[model samples]
Target: MTTTVRVLESSEEDVRRGPEIIIHENKYEFCRYNLKISRFINANLGFSAHVWDAGVALCRYFEKEKINFTGKKVIELGSGTGIVGILAALLGGYVTMTDKPKVLKQIETNVSINIPSVCRHRVNIRPLMWGENHTNFNPAYDFILGSDIVYSSVVYPALIETLRYLADQGATIYLSSELRKSNGSPDFHNNLLPHYFNCQVVDRIEGKDVVVYKMTKIATTSEEDPLPSKE
Candidate 1:
């Protein structure tokens, strides 16, 4: 689906001090989140940024699918406002939310305010630069989450490298993106085919112009062939 990229205007109230509450409703429950959004001007230009339409769509998709996150080890890359990771934690996943160092504070704040005290220990906020040496990050994560992270073409290689390095054997990956043509073609999705055995659009919210994909890593194959070689 082709979509025009339009930046939603943030009100003055949304730009003021503390975080703002955005409500995401699902068939089962409503998720109320507090996010510390960047200033309107800064956000429009993609500096740090705010909770976006695609992010909201991602949350709704999680609710609709009723994914079982209990005790799952999950990692979220480029967690702008920590919405997706926080939701995963709320659903019983042990989530690690990562972004650049500059955005870590906002992610921490969002997690602290939205996650219940009992579940707070399940969520970890950290800084991670895509493609950089991830010695500190474990490669055995059961699932990886990313929302609206395909908007930049320059980051494609880095993003793919990060995914390959972090994905465990048979790990699951969930990614959401706004279907905007201006952000470049769906090259990011195409790039994953070789690294991941199965990749497909699992859900799309047309009204919100968002698409979510479910991907799984390719299983290792034995180098030795079973067939006898012709002598």
Candidate 2:
């Protein structure tokens, strides 16, 4: 006999940081597991501490597509709230959830709470600053994921460099972003990423104003060649 799981209503769990900051949990049910994602409510804990629409959309996209994450090596960049990476782990992928050093605690907490002890070893949290020294992380990952990380043009170069270093010809990259015309996300997806990777739209979530792109490294891409400026 099999059991069916439905999307559950969200409940809150609050954690206090010092005298002022309050972190609250946003609950989600996916893959027959309940994910409790914590976020700072009144405190400005940077964007990495909060859950974004792109991340949610990507999680849904994975479930809808029935991605076979079993036994795969996965790494998620800008893993705010650790939602997407947690889902990957639940789906049987060895997942590394990464973000800025300062924001790692919340993600760690989320991972610890949601991932069962049996699946706990499959998930790891690490600090990854885009375009920085990423040598500590393995270059070969079966799948690389990012959500709402392409918001600004200023970070494009470093982000691209990091992507190039972490992804090889055999790896697949999935990036989801809310395509806001005012920001450079639209241009980055349309004009910039295509220059380096073979990119395709895997999902267009119109309701959330989000688009998920599937990208793979171009075989001829050279590390020394500069990416075209996004001016």
Candidate 3:
């Protein structure tokens, strides 16, 4: 039998330097699972820990098909709460987990606690701000990940630009979002025509909403055979 610790409803688990935690006891053991995470990677998903759990569930949608993420260059943008992206790292993606400069350390802390095994060597930390022109973008990510990043109409232009810039020639962009009443999807679709990003609704699960997108460097009208990056 293993020991278990009851999680405090609210604790002074600092959110800045170390991973803020909510220890929960299960049948066998107690674990200091981190919570209250906000921002990992670059895209801005307005975050609430409870709400972000929905996004984490969505990230695992691809696993149902048994597609291995091992040894893939993956980036989780707008990693608000960092849970999804950290999970990706644990699964074996050479994950570059970035976010805003202010919250980069926080993102680092969360990953370290949940997946200390891979954070330093595999999961890299960096700063990626949306709407800003970034020349130091990685061109080798097999998949770009985001969770619930669609927030407001004001941020649509920046978000779209950021997504386009980081995406490689043939990269799969997996996003998890709930179609909320006041989400930014409307504004995003409005600008997608003039720009080019082959977006598609691949999966929509009950508890989690999954949208798979394909992006390319050049513009093409050929919609039938958009070169898929990976499954």
| Reference-based lDDT, each prediction | 0.68, 0.80, 0.56
lDDT of 3 by residue, 84-180 (tens): 6776776777888767776665577566666766345888878887766445786677888877777665666677656666664567777655555
**How would the candidate models be sorted by lDDT, starting from the highest?**
2, 1, 3
Give stretches of model 1 more than 4 Å off: 1-15, 18-47, 191-197, 219-231
Worst lDDT 10-window in candidate 2? 1-10
Better of 1 and 3 by TM-score: 1
Best by TM-score: 2
Q: What is the TM-score of candidate 3? A: 0.67
* TM-score on alpha carbons, each prediction: 0.76, 0.88, 0.67
Error in Å for residue 3 of model 1: 16
- lDDT at 97 for candidate 1? 93
Clashes (N, CA, C under 3 Å) per candidate: 0, 0, 8
**Where's the lowest-lDDT run of ten residues in candidate 1?**
21-30
Scored by lDDT, model 3 comes in at: 0.56
Q: Model 3: runs farther than 4 Å from truth? A: 1-54, 187-195, 207-231
Cα error, candidate 1, residue 89 (Å) = 0.4
lDDT of 1 by residue, 79-144 (tens): 977778888888789999998887776677666667779889899888898877565798889999
lDDT of 2 by residue, 127-226 (tens): 9988776767887799999999987778888889788878863789999888888777888889888877899988876545688899998765366557
Q: Is candidate 1 or candidate 2 better by TM-score?
A: 2
Evaluate model 1: give its TM-score. 0.76
